[model samples]
Target: MPDSASDVFDIPADVLQRETARIFRGHGLLPNDADWVAEALVEADLRGIHSHGVTRVPIYTERLARGLFNPRPNVCVVRQGPSVVSVDGDNGMGAVVGRRAVAAAVDVVAETGCAAVGVRNSNHFGIAALYAEQLVAHGFIALVCSNAPPTMAPHGGRSALFGTNPLAFGVPAPGERQILADMATSIVARGKIILAQQRGEEIPLGWALDPDGRPTKDAATALNGVVLPFGGAKGSAIALLVDILAAVMTGAGFGTDLPDFYNDLDRPGNLGHFLLAIDPARFGERDRFLERLGRYINMIGDCPPAEGFERVQLPGEVEAGLRRKHLSSGVPLSQDILLGLRQAAGHADVSLEL
Candidate 1:
């Protein structure tokens, strides 16, 4: 363990994945589904997004055991066109549903030079970047969006009326580096607030509002309240666009109609996601595209920093740096998260060494 007060103990990435898989399998998920789900969660943790990491394992396990989620959903491609496809998640794990959609999109793009896919009846798919990165690895530009449970309010509306609605974009670079941008439309993701609450910490004033719509530092109250949009109206507009494209376009539940990921375990959460893959070679020379991208990145990196700042990083640079550091050092597993995983393992009849 690191001596720093803010630092956390790092566990090997494979250990975390095994533990996660064990817990999920205990809850009745098939071995393959459990492996994919665990991989996605562990990958998120490795990328430094602790909010969506193993901390969520217990909740997922409990939901699955309680019959809130279908452990063996028959996820299938429901419709197919030359450039477009649609999938029915059949209430299966979100990671499985998301991977299937990305695979479908990649196959279509390979043949037609471009493809778009919409998925419905899925659960939370962890990080959107995971799917986008798949396309990036295949020499394609990827765009992904998903509609989440309502956590944000529409502009001028005091009640929660919209989802955080994350969007991800990824473009392959010349070398191993890829330009990836993944973020929620809200001022802060709901996962961060949940983490703060679990740690008994308070959040910044602007991250969320109180139940009465007043800014508050309390995480629990903010969980009940509404999260603020990223750029006020601009972010609200983006959230609306994501909801329409992911949910409405896919004929999934929209707005307040979506089920809660945790609390409501009786019904299937009709969540939706959209993925697009564009083959750069279709429009321009691959090398030329990469050269221009490299130039743009260099220009951004060369920008003069303000006082106390050292560099201007692209969207995924910080995450990539953190991932590199954590991969070698280990991933941090908080006591609370560990306890949850242990409890989930016990419930699933799996013995966890941690």
Candidate 2:
């Protein structure tokens, strides 16, 4: 349960997971599938990434009720080559579909030492890190990517043409959490804009441009505009690379063909995803690779910090730390989300027990 603070509650991780799983099941997902999706979103929240957390349950359930996606889809996998696989999600929930893809890739790598998996006709899969994390656990280095609806414009171009395509990587390690990096090519995720708009907050300039391609601070306006690409043209190029691999190769809808999940509730996203799993044993001794990987993480943390910062922080370190703290201290959630959860529970016929 959350505390008596100002419109805030600190829900425990297990409680949230149980309740969320129940809601998903009530919405037509099988028990196991519901649990998987619940874990994905709850993990995002535990890592302090509120943008991809349970706040999404409302919209997701609404879409579910509208029959935009298959609550129980038959995710089919086909071998493309000796070590390549392709998956058709049947318009399934991204979390469920992504897990199936990663699992298939891991299985292929188990037989071939390396694997590439392409996924198509899926909906918005949450964080890309989840798949990478899964592969790393199976002793494989992993790269994952997904294409989103249009949010970012090509460098020096005016309207949106490319998605805020995201990529993630996970390196294998023995005594460490492994090196994990997940990022959207855009300066920020559009979900952050939606969160800001809900909070009546202003967005930072330079993060996005208005519909006319001018910088804007209003979160709602910025959302209606184009999100900026990170590192200018370089990031735009990376985003294009992601789109080609995740969309073109996977045969999913690309660029603007994919409708926004929020704006067009009944339209299936038909998103694309890609995953690569490489065995460290193929390069050298697995033990040595793990040792070196752990060394690098320690060295990075040991570096002295610049002014205004206490120490160097790795890409996933902050979120990992937040996860550890929240697991014991309870997950802090806003009242608005709590209320929405209540509504979602009612719609799905799940008991929130608030």
Candidate 3:
């Protein structure tokens, strides 16, 4: 659900962060873990990806309270080889598991020049870009993949059999931001449709199909149906690849075996994620690599704009721009979403005025 200025309320990032952490802490998460999770969600909000931001607080806290997700778990990292490791999240919060996994990857990458970390038994980790950005900040190229609960159908099939599996990649770029690409394989993330449904808004055609396999704009119907994959077969194929690496290889649930994060309260999500990090200096001089990468980025940026479009922008450029602007102004939240957040805060006995 896209937000318009007329229907939004601005909350300063720092204030939102404090309140969100309080809510999580009130719900039983350890103070440090709650703070980290709050920062992660707020970072997404600052970047304008509200679907994965604070809007998720209600469902997340609900699941936590219901004991569907672990508020605290002993995340274990097992080193399989010189550069390979495995993580067992013990049914922990996905972002918490992801934070630990990425930290292990960073250490491995520092030791071996590259790392491959497989994670299992985790819940929904919001925004893969968070880990990618962290790796990029360490001057390492990163590829992050996560297998979610199934929401999309296999190519040519009408049943929901595939996750809107997401993939993210990031590398250090000249100046401020990294060259980052993060996306769900579906035509749109299921969260957007969920948001639309929550707001009683209609979705766009081609985003999903009704149960009868007919295209529909009704968000509720779409949720009952299946989301379409982007680029049809191509996206479906990529989704399968992500599932293989993130779920199958990591010993997590796949296909229908994966429980829905929103509807399945009886079991843990048992989701999986894979992270790969490569130090650029592993192959050549770090300065030379940076210089060449800068030149390539400049070439892309200087490309002529196509009709109805501005000059070429790197992947994540728009989100980065929004982040900078929102840091000073504030993150925008729809009225409905704000109300929901407040209600969630109340449930945890945490007062939230924003």
Candidate 4:
């Protein structure tokens, strides 16, 4: 462990994944389930998405231990049609439920060329890109979205009533150059503020408002308050759409109906997710679609960068570059996060040096 919480540790990705898996297993997750969740979390760290990465381990394990989320879930399929499926996550961790839903979609798309999956009774699923990329790898265009516990107010409201709903999209292009876009409707995810609070750091001025509805830069104040939407009303509208599709349509909690994941340890997080997969082969020739998408990708890549920017890059290009660099250099994690991971590991009698 580092001498100070501010110190940074660059641990190997595989090592972190293995240790995290062990920690989760110690918390009662089955071996395969533990591995899957650990891999997704570490992959997010590899891509520089720390807010959705292993920093979440402490809360996740705590929730599991407290029975706030089911460590072992049945993940039953409630309904299915030719191309649409509805899943009941059985109050499991969202990462596990989301993967199971994606697997069902992949199986269906293999025969139907398209599949829409709605998942309810789930917990937080980390990041939507985790599932979107899975479909993209299977030669499908993917759109994935999820509704979280309300942390943002509606467009003009003051009290928290809308979630920082997130959406992710992915399309296979050429080689390892596929397009993957993931973002929250909020100015920033609440997890970022939570992380800032954990690190004793201040947030940017515009990220959130205090409980009094005044904009605040204090992380703790922001957590007690509400986060702002990304593009004002536009972002709010997108969030509404996500809630409708992911929560309302999926029979999950929405708006004030959902329990906050961090504060509401007494209740399960009844989150929801919507996953759609479309096979290019269904529209026409898969190769032809890829060729056209390749041309489109080239067109975007050729665009000149504006001032203050280095170059034009696709949606996931920056993160992909970061992943390539970090894979060998190791993943940079703050000692604060390391401390939390250490405590979590100790609970399971697992010793982690990093």
Candidate 5:
């Protein structure tokens, strides 16, 4: 088993993916679903988003082993109208259900030029960018968002009433980087707090408040308390919009109805997500759109930065760059996380090879 005194393990991406899949498969997941979960987790790690990566495998598999979610869901889809499609996830893993939803939207948009797919009864799907990036890869503009478990306080309120409520968008740019952005409506995601706690670091003030409505720097206190909204009322308002579309409109649990992912081990999350896609070809030629996007990227890069900043960067640039670097060197995971994952795998007699 891994220990803190050891150097951080640098596992090959492919090896980590297979090990993750093997552990999930041992826990009664289908081969395809196991693979999907593994790949999604590895991708998040590769992109340097440790909060959404393999660090989550222990909690996920624990819930799965305890019968919190369906290992194999009979996901169903219904066409609401010419441009609307409804998906029932049947309590499936978020990544697996999300892939099915995006695939359905792609099929519908091919004929309708645009489509909206609403999803319900899913678990935390890792990262929203993973879903939106699919549309960008297929030459379509996509918007994706999800409602999480309640952790953020509404504007001017002391009690937590909303999830971080993330929003993600991806637009295709032929010659330029993909316009992919995934952000939380709060000052920071709940994941960041979890990460800080794991690393034993204090958080910056204004990021979160204690349970009694006092600003806090302690990560653990913030997790038990409330995460603050980004721009006071504005971010809270956006979180509300996301909750409405991704949960209320999708016929899934909203606000107080959702279960706590960290503590609740035997109950399904009943999470929901929403996806909207538009084919650029419908508005104009694909080549023209790509070229225009490249122009805008160049124009923005040419601007002068303020004294404290270096150069301008787009939304997806940093993560994309990190991915390229990690792919060659392997992903660095802390000994604590590696040991936890090892313990989880060991229970199933799965060899992690970390």
Candidate 6:
């Protein structure tokens, strides 16, 4: 059933986690890996970014069953320099590989006050904010970028030539509220289009082009077509930068050779991610910096609203509020995604409730 905008759906957070864990375990993921993956998916839902939430569980399970993803592959730091490290994911689950990379970056930054880590051969690791927030919790500023399978075309091109190329940045604050910005270079992330298709809704024009290279609003057709960059040349330029940093710099798959995260089971996806962690204390007095940040934030917040707007919000503020509300209530799932999850569970010999 399609959910009405005002209609609320609620499930206990623990129940949602357990359901996800069950789904992952049934797909042959180890207990620890299942837990971490479940947490990441749930975190996305809590933050109201349903595109990266449990809706993707079925896809992940399908990839696992098709032998396209390894549930028990090795993840190791292959090379380490003074302030840089490279990790090989060995076709493992992306949640595991991504977490390991973040952990390594955290460790390096703790010692060197700054560190950059590149990971290759990983899978879809969900929201970039998850990794950035991890570093934020440790009082370090974090920047993360990932290269996806090519679904976006570069400027002046008619065919797909670049990945959506997501980027995320996070900074720790004095209080519980951390500042974060996460977005895809495209006009819309593929996950959002997927969600629209699943919900049988039409997307806005200019969001994507049909396979024949014409503007389209049909979500299903858009999936086969190319997603436009956010601001034309500017977004396309950023996508190129992400490709350089996340794919070329890390020696992972790039451009047309990037593996499709959804299908194509023949080869390893070789998704690449780049992460940086920087300790504020190393640059100046931490207390003073935070104080200044707080003041700046207040100034932004105190700006007068325009038209029907009530207030201004800093990056991540809306998401943080949504997360708090969802945690107490429940993360809403579209009926289509719910059915897909049930089907995946059945295939894995696992049971799902509603």
Highest TM-score: which candidate? 4
Per-model TM-score on C-alpha atoms: 0.96, 0.96, 0.96, 0.97, 0.97, 0.95
Over the stretch 45-136, how does candidate 1's per-residue lDDT look in tens digits? 99999988898888888778877778888998954778999999998889988988988888898899999899998989999999999998
lDDT of 6: 0.88
Ranking by TM-score: 4, 5, 3, 2, 1, 6
Compose the digit string of candidate 6's lDDT tens values, residues 243-301.
89988999889998977777676777899999999999999999988999888888887
Tens digit of per-residue lDDT, candidate 2, span 250-287: 89999888888788875788999999999988889888
lDDT of 4 by residue, 28-138 (tens): 999999998998899999999899899999999999888998999999975478999999999998889999999999999999999999999998898889899999999
Per-model clash counts, in order, read 0, 1, 0, 0, 0, 0
Give me the runs in candidate 1 sitting further than 4 Å from their true place. Answer: 1-7
Model 4 scores worst on lDDT over the 10 consecutive residues at: 153-162
Clashes of 1: 0
Better of 2 and 4 by lDDT: 4
Clashing pairs in 4: none
Query: Which parts of model 5 are misplaced by more than 4 Å?
Result: 1-7
Residue 39 lDDT in candidate 4: 88
User: Would you list the C-alpha lDDT of every candidate in the order shown?
Assistant: 0.88, 0.89, 0.91, 0.91, 0.90, 0.88
lDDT of 5 by residue, 113-132 (tens): 99999999998998899999
Give the clashing residue pairs of candidate 2, or none: 2-10
lDDT of 3 by residue, 1-354 (tens): 336523976788999999999988888889888988898899989988888999899889999988988899899999999999999999888889999999999999999999999999998889999999999989999999999998999889899999999999999887764699999999999989997887788999999999999899999999999999999999999999999999999999999998888888788789999999999999999999999998998889789999999889889998899999999998888777777788988898888867
What's the TM for model 4? 0.97
